[model samples]
Target chain A: MIDIYEIIGLIAATLTTSAFVPQVYKAWKSKNTESLSLTMYLAFFVGIMLWLVYGIHLNSLAMILSNTATGFLALILIILKLKYK
Target chain B: MIDIYEIIGLIAATLTTSAFVPQVYKAWKSKNTESLSLTMYLAFFVGIMLWLVYGIHLNSLAMILSNTATGFLALILIILKLKYK
Candidate 1:
């Protein structure tokens, strides 16, 4: 039986994970990452990486999915910031 | 006994939670959120809220603390975005 709460977790994961799309799109289109803070994203990436580790420890699907997805997005932004500036 | 992994999670939470400070400071200092995506933060806020709920359900201290802390920062950014633009 699928837990409704887990279902909610998945939905939440989807929402948060997809939230990076617009930023990535805009950054890709504009070729500008001046406004995006590199420090924030780097810290975020590290944090997400840790979260992934912790999630794996707990065997949480939601944490795993959300962090993995967003970690990639943050990497993109981080790379963009590096390439652009 | 405090689990070492849980300690890692707390440190990770602190890293991620503190990541927002520079952003809020930057936005507030410049009064420019043109670079910050409102949709991204809005989606993130909602997602974090859900995570908080899920964390509460599972009684996960790290998840609860991290989301609650970051959620406040995200809200600050959201409000700043609205105020600036």
Candidate 2:
């Protein structure tokens, strides 16, 4: 059975990672990413990459899933920044 | 000796977590957080908490350090949101 901690983790992951959705939508709709920093996203991208590797090493599905989605979201922003900026 | 992957993880952690500095500075300087979302920050805070637990489990300094810092930064934003909004 799932514990309270796991439930909390799932909820947390769902919310935080899903938070990117609005930003992604905003960027996509406005097609303006002037305020978004590329350097920050790049760094975040790399960070997520490492987290993915770490998840793989640990065989943690939650980490892998969350980071993979987050990485993709960050990548979208990065691409948008490059394209629109 | 640390491997290449560890070095990359360190750099990623430093950059992404440190990226919060600019946002924090902007919020602090302007004393305006109208644009920041409270729900997002709250969600992020919880996510970081889980990541911290995960880091502890794996004894991964990089994960621990990055998430701890990010959690604090996210908390700041949450507080600022509550205070300003």
Candidate 3:
């Protein structure tokens, strides 16, 4: 049986990681990322990559799923920042 | 022997999560979050909480450490946004 903590973790990961979606959508739709810093996104992108590697090492599905999705979303912003800026 | 993957994971978590420090510092020093969207930070704050819960669930030291640090940093920015703005 899954414990309450595990359930909470799952819900938390799902919600927070998914939070990037709106920002991603905004960046894409507006085609503007001038306010967003390239340095910040670059650092974040690298950080997410590391998290992915760490997730893979732990063989944890939650880490993998959340980081993967977050990484992708961050990447979208990074790309938009690049493309539009 | 410690595996390469685990080392990578540790490094990744440390670097990426810590990357927020500069932004946090900038926000703290400049006291300017006008460009920052409160919604993004709010969502990120919630997401980090979930990640923390997930980390606690997995009993992963890396997750706990990284998320805790990230959450704290995000919280700082959030507070500054509130206080200064």
TM-score of each: 0.89, 0.86, 0.81
**By DockQ: ranked, best first:** 1, 3, 2
lDDT of 1 at A82: 98
**DockQ result, candidate 3:** 0.60
TM-score, candidate number 3? 0.81
Docking quality band of candidate 2, CAPRI definitions: acceptable
> What is the C-alpha DockQ of each candidate?
0.70, 0.47, 0.60
Residue B1 local lDDT, model 3: 80
As for lDDT, the candidate ahead, 1 or 3, is: 1
User: lDDT of all predictions, in order shown?
Assistant: 0.87, 0.79, 0.79
Q: Which ten residues in a row have the lowest lDDT in candidate 2 chain A?
A: A3-12
Q: Write one digit per residue (lDDT tens) for candidate 1, span B1-85.
A: 8898788788789988888788788888999989788988998899889988988887778888998998999999999999988
- Best-fitting candidate, measured by DockQ? 1
> Total backbone clashes of model 2?
0
- The positional error of residue A69 in candidate 3, measured at the CA in angstroms, is 1.0
List of clashing residue pairs for candidate 2:
none
Regions of candidate 2 where Cα sits further than 4 Å from its true position: A1-10, B1-8
lDDT of 3 by residue, A1-85 (tens): 8667656666766876866687788788889887678887788888788888877777766767877888888888888888899
How would the docking of model 3 be graded?
Answer: medium
Can you list the residue pairs that collide in candidate 1? none
Error at A1, model 3, angstroms: 4.9
Candidate 1 lDDT score at position A80:
93
